[model samples]
Target: MAGEIPRAQPPPAEPDPVRDAHPYVLLWQWRRNPLRRRTDRLRAWIALGLALFVLLAAPAAMYAVGDTVHRHYRSTAEHEARTRDQRPAVLVHDAPRHPEPGSDEARETRYPVEVRFTGPDGAVRTGTTDVEPGLPADSTVLVWVDAAGEITGPPLTADEIRSRTMGWALLAFLGVVLAGLAAHGVAGLVLHRRNLAGWDAAWADTARRWTRAP
Candidate 1:
């Protein structure tokens, strides 16, 4: 008996309290940790609110701005067309003209088919007429020119211009909003990844401390 090695003391019985406990223990532990619990809740709520705001407000804002821009462009185009139609033709002498051949230089008669009007601000404006073969010099003729410098017999109506302008504006607004949403989603993903990394680090730290306890 003296020579025989004493039987190794039975290994200390491992605690079975946690082994039999419900899985809810882990959940309760996590919930009780102030820092971890608060951070998780705050992050969740913040993400939810941001998502809701983007979902609801983005389309509405885009629509409102697009409508405003469309209306503005349409009104401006229509008003300009009307004003051009109403402007009276003026008479001028020695207006530039294309020459015809086989005419005597000394007795050649020149007639005006267009007139130029100088505005009060010294801007020279011109009009042309197709109704008359030639407008006599110092005589008036009526004509209309559109924004693109092409002669127009009838100006565009408000409704016609609005339809086209609204279509273009809405298309552009949609493109912009979609691009913004895409960028926002990418940013959110990056932030979420960083937050996840932080959470993992905190979890590891907590676990290490728990295991090291006396």
Candidate 2:
């Protein structure tokens, strides 16, 4: 018996109280073990912070972004409307009489047509733009232009502004989530590596006694 190898003993069984409880019960580590490591406490605090941010800060950030975008776009729309003018022009030729099935006109409900309009500079300009289908030659159409006789885009409408605001809000929310996830992920990785190193050091010290031969 003196020279024989000792067999490993089974570890004591742990209590199973609340084994089926939800995993998110608050302060679980602190309550379960008074001697929990600093890393564990730090992780708990980080989780609590992230949860609070998701509930309160995320929505606030999204709304702020959306409001800012709406205001900017609205201002731009008002400025453009003030600077630009929509003038009535005569169609040089008729839009396509008919479009093939599933064609651009059929999809968009508009077809390209050539039109002539006089700008504020007293110069006539001819250009092609989309208009509703089935208009005959010499038909009156509206075109937007600046003072320089150059065709320009129409001012943003209410529907477009609302759509853009929603899009920016969604983007802002996603950005917050992505940033939070990245930060938490890095913290978790650092904590994991620290835990591994701690375990290795503990095992190295504890193993000496078991390996020592009497």
Candidate 3:
């Protein structure tokens, strides 16, 4: 065994979160090493901050945004349901039964038409509303009317509110993550340049000392 040449050890494998919390993986640069620069430690701190932000602040922000969106949508739905009323309307004219020629619209696209309805106050209201295609004039239809008897769109459904809240909440979470990454990247770049500048200064000082004029 003494005469056999020693084999080189294999390089360390990449970090595995499943294997461990990988705390050392994140703080590797923070360790005391002769080759490590001040900027390297700063970069490690920045990485740790970014990780914490993603784990903590990002979720908090997402919850806050989702809650706000849900509350807003729910409030609007309640308000509309309370202030608005559905009424039977009579079509003043025929509804468009067919899509326009050379158009991408479906044959059953609902088209706006003039209609007459009684409002919550029972006063007659005339407004334009979308109706199924091909309804002849003087057809009975149901429409939504505001407190002032103005025609309005239907309120949001439960599913729609949840879906929209989730969509915006996801976007908010991603936005926060991207913002943190961008900030960290910028900080790293600045620190890297500073580190290079420090090295350049050290080399220049060394050159001046070694080549001093006789």
Candidate 4:
């Protein structure tokens, strides 16, 4: 009995849930854990960079678009104001209720109507211009006129410019954010595939060693 060898104890069984119940880490790949691989760290850094890029680049794009749109619309308004002016005009005929064929009702809400307006030279003039439907004959309406006394559209209002700038800026911001997210997703997919391949190779190596075991 004193010379007998002791029996080898079996390893304890590990449940999947228990093995995977590790606490969440904010940036586990950035840690110096022995299980962390070079690809893992690279993927973590890439994710961080993309997140920063989205935050920084989105606002930058928004501001650039807003400034550019504001300047262009402001200049356009100034030019139109200089070249155009409003004139008192009387409708000579009823405004057409029906929109022209192949026209969008949303945009072509107003129909063209004949109007009598005073010219730049003080002579009475007749012109066809846009007006709301159902306007009766002899109804007064303010019409825009160009330098040559021709009927024209009104200049861009402040409200219109501000709205357009805000819309474009918002679109630019969304575009930047979406682009950054897409890039990050693509990079993550690539890293995930690489990690899977490495894991497969390591498992294969382990299996081969197990087959040769006594």
Candidate 4 lDDT over 1-214, as tens digits, reads 3333333233223123335665545556676978777877887788889889999999999999999999999999999999998999999988765545445763458778899999888889999888877779999999999889999889999999999999999999999989988997798788777777776776666656555535
**Cα lDDT listed for each candidate:** 0.55, 0.78, 0.80, 0.81
Q: What's every prediction's RMSD, in angstroms?
A: 16.7, 5.4, 9.7, 9.9
- For residues 1-214, what per-residue lDDT tens digits would candidate 1 score against the true structure? 2233232233233223257576664344235454444444554455556667667666676677667877777777677666555334566544444364344642365443556654334466765544333344666555565544434566566676668666766676566657556765666566556666765676666556555636
Residue-level lDDT for 69 in candidate 1: 70
Give the candidate number with the greatest lDDT: 4
Model 1 residue 108 distance off true place after TM-score fit, in angstroms: 40
- Residue pairs whose backbone atoms clash in candidate 4: none
Q: For residue 173, what is the lDDT in candidate 3?
A: 91
Pairs with steric clashes in candidate 2: none
Q: Residue 11's C-alpha lDDT in candidate 2?
A: 32
Per-residue lDDT of model 2, residues 43-146, tens digit only = 76887788677777778889999999999999999988888999988899988756565677566787878899888887888988788777889999889987
Model 4, stretches more than 4 Å misplaced? Answer: 1-24, 96-112, 116-133, 147-150, 212-214
Better of 1 and 3 by TM-score: 3
Off by over 4 Å in 2: 1-27, 100-108
- Decreasing lDDT order of the candidates: 4, 3, 2, 1
Worst 10 residues of 1 by lDDT: 6-15
TM-score of each: 0.37, 0.75, 0.77, 0.69
Per-residue lDDT, model 3, residue 140, is 94
